[model samples]
Target: MTAYNKEEIIHQLESHQLWIDTLGKEGNKLGFDEVDFCNIDIDLIKYPLDQAYLTACTFDGMNLYGKDMHSSLICSSTFITTNLENADFYKADVSYVDFTNANVKNARYAKSDCSEAIFIKADLTNAKLISCSLYLTDFREATLKNVDVSSSSFKGVLLKGAKLSGIKGLEDAFIKSINIGTPEIPILIEGEEAVQWIINNCSTDEQI
Candidate 1:
């Protein structure tokens, strides 16, 4: 419940960077709770934010390529149009985050709780979402080619216009009612029928 000013936040970040640079021998790791990071420039911050509590932060349009954010609490954050390619979000609490138009290709979201998150038009090609909680998440018009969603929960997820060619582990996922059409039109499907439609429509070799 501590609030930090910009200068104090910068000092902590510098110390964390030193810790990362010296392999945890020089400084302490960054670990803040209930802090707001909307005003901060995320580009200047160092990578490997593992186990940090970054709840409700806004990282719009930032280049966060290959950042190690595993086990972080990033719930309700906004990453609009951010370049999150190769970012490791393993076991992170990403619930209700907005990733609209973000380039999240090859990101690792295994064991993460991504419930109610928005991925509208985001490119998640080749991403690993195994054992994740995706309940009520939106993926409208997103590119999910070759993505592995093994043992994930997709209850009430939106998949309208999402490219799912070469996607893996549909049978292993626990899917409930999902939207396969626009929000205005609202075509809902469930169980085996929904899986079949996703496979038949998106499993084609034709380019999307």
Candidate 2:
């Protein structure tokens, strides 16, 4: 496990305060739309980014293990290849965020609105997404082994080429046009029982 550098992170965030100050108007004109937050721990409860209106941020290779970010208002951020094991994102409005290739094992995303978010090739083993609003979310080629999506709304979600083995709570969730296998087969399941039926019948391909 990596260590969390609190002071250094605070310094860096403070250094980027000017960008936050000019985010909406001047920052956009100056092309300062992204923030690099690699390899740090973020305690959003103390220093929040809820109203930052930040876009296209990067969090590659960061250590965010077990960090609580309930009700945060981050959007369109990228977390590629980051360590997010056991992180809590309950009720966070994290729409359109990219979590590609990130380690999200055992992460809590209950009641969060992750609409249109990208999770391509992400490791979501054992993650809890209970009651999450996952409308139009993309999970292409991602690993979903042991993931719990109970009561989560996955309307219009994309699951093409994704590994859906061992996932829980598809018995009571909305679904439409979610691919379960290769595009050649074009598996489109509807409702909870159909999802379970596909899972039981389909043979998994290479896990992402």
Candidate 3:
């Protein structure tokens, strides 16, 4: 992770604006070096980003902790192994984003679109995703501890072998074709199979 000055980093980001719309059309954006675009406080820029179109920008091993990216359109961006802890992603469209092995702990993604996003082996502990649209998102072997997924749509999402311990708010989340691991806590979904499985698991315990 090579470090650059504030002026040098801003120049690189500004130069890639023309090609940020489509990938391979102009040129490649975002280097492997650590560019602190979020932590910069310069006189040139007034406020942070809004509705920023950052397509195909790779952010591998970057620390994007606690950034508010509300309503941003980040399509086809690769966030490989990035630390996205406690990021406020309200209604953001992160379709086809590679979040594989990223630290997404306590991330709030209310009404966000995470369709086809890969979350393989990511530490998503205590993440709250209220009313979010997660159609066909991959959650293979990810830790979903205490995740609040209320009123969300999980159509065709792969949750096979995911650690869903202490997960909350599944009363309205659609579970079509989603692979459920051995639920330690009581699941809050519809269907006779789900009810029976919870009943069987709760029979030995005193609480229902």
> Each candidate: how many clashes?
0, 0, 0
lDDT tens per residue, model 3, 1-208: 3456787756655544434556437634533233334445543223233345555555667677886666677767777788889877788888888888999999988888988888887888888888888777778778777788888877656665566566677666655444343223322343545423433432221222
Model 1 lDDT tens row, 9-113: 888777877887898899887777555555665444354577677777767888889888898899988899999999999999999999999999999999999
TM-score of each: 0.84, 0.70, 0.67
- Worst 10-residue lDDT window for candidate 3 reads 199-208
lDDT of 3: 0.65
Better of 1 and 2 by lDDT: 1
Report the candidate with higher TM-score, 2 versus 3: 2
Local lDDT at 12 for model 2: 43
Error of 3 at 36 (Å): 13
Error of 1 at 30 (Å): 3.8
Per-residue error at 130 for model 3, in Å?
1.0
Ranking by TM-score: 1, 2, 3
